[model samples]
Target: MNKTTWAMVTFSVGLGLSACGEEAGGPTVEQVAKAYEMYMNVNLATELGQRIEVRGWEDFKPGCKSSGPERVKCITGGKVELMGFQGGEQTVPKPVSVPAEFDLEFEKRENTWVPVRAQKK
Candidate 1:
């Protein structure tokens, strides 16, 4: 087989094996909170065209439950600065500290839980 085909087969086999060996149980509260923060930052990056970090997880809560065999649902919230640049050259989106709250759902793929939904609350 060519090098490209060999690499593809290897990757496919690895992915299949990983799925078969996926972790069980819901993620920890800390992990759920961090995942929420990451998703929020990703959203802000698109709208603000810059990174605005989510912070203050000291009072964080994951109120998570098993929504499915490999899924979890959480009611969580946090804060982030809504400050971005001033135009298409980073146009002003206003700079202000804001509450970031959401009802999020995650699915376990392999060993990590990935956010599958983020409904604003």
Candidate 2:
């Protein structure tokens, strides 16, 4: 193979290895919050045929002073606009803004974090 082709192949292999190594960390606080928001939205839609418009989060921080590597806890305040179904057959739309507080616990499973428990504060 030509020198240019060899260099490209070597770079590609190194890039792939780096990408694999990058996957070995747990999710950040923001990622956990996002996931929680998504979970809430999916659950609401499935159970009540409603949807939430996530405004944002506040006071997001680690729940414990020194949480171990395996388990993590986080607390945050979230704002969401809840859209409810109204009228006949729940076909109408009514949206209301709601603020919520959350305490979430996660466990590091392999390379990802999974929420083990969640509660509203």
Candidate 3:
């Protein structure tokens, strides 16, 4: 077979295998949001404690706040900033933001709302 034909065959096989091997109990938006929150809590707590231990002051803070719903905007060290969602009743819109944190960048994967791999921020 020609190179193009062989490449197509390989691509097809890979796609089929990946689809078949998809993990069970696939992650959901709710799960990802919760994981994100847990990660943030732990990481931020550690950072806060570390600064206190090293600098002898708890003045340092992670400037962030919940913008209603499951959304949060965090600005860290005046450089990096992250926006995330943790599915909840407060999510924007009346019914609820099903795909809560739906279109947000730090949320999309392959154009679909997929569970975050980091399991934490």
Candidate 4:
């Protein structure tokens, strides 16, 4: 092969190898967990005067090994607190606490992680 062609081939191979070694561009396991916790807390507080307090997370997987880049799933645990009404005509309800689990799925689109599904388990 010509010197110019050989140089181009070498450069292409190097670039491909570098790209392969790089990590995927998307939210990490911790970031995804934090976002999910925040979403649950905000929605619950808005709708039910309650919020979920995340104590910790476990069984977190950043990417789906079997399904490849298209799907990722994470699981977490927390406690949900049912807040009492403050300064409302209705009587204040007693606060209730419950243990909760979350199952979350995320998809990769154009190098970004998009939440595809979320469930309370």
**lDDT values of the candidates?**
0.52, 0.45, 0.26, 0.44
Off by over 4 Å in 2: 1-26, 42-45, 53-55, 58-69, 78-98
Q: How many residue pairs clash in each candidate?
A: 4, 0, 1, 0
CA lDDT for candidate 3: 0.26
Candidate 1 backbone clash number: 4
Candidate 2 lDDT, 11-89, residue by residue in tens: 1112221111122444454555454555565444445555444443343343332147676565545454444443324
In model 4, the runs with Cα more than 4 Å from the true position are 1-27, 49-69, 77-100
Which residue pairs of candidate 2 clash? Answer: none
Candidate whose TM-score is highest: 1
How well does model 1 score by local distance difference test?
Answer: 0.52
Residue 35 Cα positional deviation in candidate 1, in Å, after optimal superposition: 1.9
Candidate 2 C-alpha error for residue 54, in Å? 2.7
Backbone-clash count (model 3): 1
TM-score for each model: 0.56, 0.48, 0.23, 0.43
| Root-mean-square deviation (CA) per prediction | 10.7, 14.4, 19.8, 16.3
- Candidate 3, residue 119: Cα displacement in angstroms equals 7.8
Worst 10 residues of 1 by lDDT: 4-13
Candidate scoring better on lDDT of 1 and 2: 1
Candidate 1, position 45, lDDT: 56
